[model samples]
Target: MKPVEIAKGVYDVGVIDWNIRDFHGYSTHLGTSYNAFLIVDEKIALIDTVKKGFAEQLLRNISTIIDPGKIDMVISNHTEMDHSGSLPYIMDKIGIQKPLYCSKMGEKNLSRHFSSDLNYQVLKEGDEISLGSKTLTFIETRMLHWPDSMFTYLKEDKILFSSDAFGQHYAGHEEFDDVVGNKIMFHAQKYYANILLLYAPLILKLVEKITKAGLEFNIICPDHGVLWRNPGRIIEAYAKWSKQEDCADKAVIVYDTMWDSTHQMALAVADGLHENGIDVRPMKLRDWDRSDIMTEVLDAKAVIIGSPTLNNGIFPTIADFITYMKGLKPKNKIGAAFGSFGWSGESVKIIEQNLGEMNFDLPVSGLKIPFVPDNNGLEKCREFGSQLAKAIKG
Candidate 1:
């Protein structure tokens, strides 16, 4: 696809990889792109670069418009190899002594990956760099996804160079969010649920900081996805997402079973929840995706976890799910656990232990069916559902 002029002097030179099926082992079922931007002010600047293997193509794309040597500033928004891996080669090819810019943490990461001698000009929070015609202002957004993360704003254009925040793994030549439509929202949720969910508090702080800074951004150029022309839409949406608040009247029940006994118990619980006018999505851990469940939990008010005992422990898949949830820190929700065990009957306790370690304020209600779940045990599962619903409602 031809590189398109996204706005005046702002070009979307990032490539579309329809052939790519996965990104860093995360299944990008809808494909993705590495978004890079070029800003032409008095001193031309390349905000970020692309992958190392695509160095040749990246240069060729830049060559079509302007002399690579004339690029006066290079900003490394993220030190993730995907974004900054080509910096060494790009600098060598252009014979550029122009300073590479990033946070101090980003500089450390760059040194580790490339070499100690790789020249970098580090900026702290609220630092500014003059581009002759326009000024680039920095805002340190630590742990939005990485400690080294940051955003740059062009004073003249009101454009925010957000590295990963508001980014998606969507691959397309379309430069605008309105053009991308539903895919933008879908991939945004996928990206947020998997990557930025845990840092919701930081994100909320960032929103407040940006507003308090009075940075009027009309354009948003993110690192890995489409640029935003309608800045308010994204900003308003971010305001809600960063609050760790649910957006739905639904619940997600994630369970893993052995020998169909625990599975039966899960189904009984789901039936009872549905009977109580709750929208229940009962998922089996065998093929349930952690990221998918994360997206579900992002909007869910209640959650139910289940696993069958395996060697006096919770099932491995269930364990992995809890680990992911804990890392993502899905807050502002009520949750509980259930399982079936033969001997030790420790699966529920283990699940509770994991939840407690994550500092989740889970209401005290967990269940474990002894041996096999019979009709009587099914009643217990239904009762657990009732307790969970009551907690969620309260």
Candidate 2:
């Protein structure tokens, strides 16, 4: 992508990856962008860089506006390879002597990725740097996802160069929020569910810190996806998501079946939830990706998982989903387990145990069938669903 001016003299000189399907195991079906910004002032500064393999594309984009060598300083917002993978190459090409500004942890992290002798200028929160008409203020966002993350604010322009706070893994041509409209929010939700859900508490604290500091922005330029031209839109969205309290009056039934018995049980449970006036989504493991399922779990008040026993243990796919979900640490959820077993009925007990470990409100003892569930067994599953719905309502 060529350099596009975001504001008066600021340009978004970033590279778009239109074919990347997987990002460190998180499915990026919509691809993504490694965004960097360039400011033209008395002292020109480049904020962030693209991934390592796309260094040429980044440099080409920069060339469209001005020679990259003329850039007086470089800012490292996050040391993640996707954002800072081209740091060494850019620094080498544009005089390694130029100062690279970053947070204290960024200095340590980047030095490990590149040569240790490169120029590194560390700045703390509230530090300011002047570039003629525009001034940049630093805000340290420790563990907003990474320890090295920080945001740069253009005081005069009222723009916040947020590193990764409100980013989405969407590779759309539209660079502004209003142009993309509501569709951008779905991508943002998926991004938050898959990437930032585990850090919800830290995100809440960061949002409160920024608000208390009285920082205002006309635009929020993140290191990925589109810029938030409607500044308050994403901030409001993040604030809601970080609280983890605004869940839909819905339930997600996630399961995998060996012989369709578990699938039938899942459907029965869905019927019960529907009867209770709760929105229900039944996802067979084969038909849904784990990341997509996790996104569904984000706004769901309850998660009901079913699995057929295999090798005297839960289905591998269900095991994988449980591991992934547990790591994400979703809170304020009610959970229940149901499944069919040929001999030992251990899967339901195992699921219930895991959910209890995660601190979910478990109201039922879980339902288990010895073989293909009979009509009576299915009714029991429905009753289990009704119990979960009641818990959600309460």
* Backbone N/Cα/C clashes per model: 0, 0
Candidate 1 lDDT, 198-229, residue by residue in tens: 88888888898888878897888888778888
The Cα RMSD in angstroms, rounded to one decimal, for candidate 1 relative to the true structure is 2.1
Q: Per-residue lDDT for 40 in model 2?
A: 95
Q: Scored by Cα lDDT, where does model 2 land?
A: 0.91
Best by lDDT: 2
lDDT of 1: 0.80
C-alpha RMSD for every candidate: 2.1, 1.1
- lDDT digits (tens) for residues 320-373 of candidate 2: 999999999999999999999999988998999999999998987788998898
- For residue 66, give model 1's deviation from the true position in Å: 1.9
Each prediction's TM-score against the native? 0.92, 0.98
Error of 1 at 257 (Å): 2.1
lDDT of each: 0.80, 0.91
- Model 1: ten consecutive residues of lowest lDDT: 18-27
Please list all clashing residue pairs in model 2, or write none if there are none: none
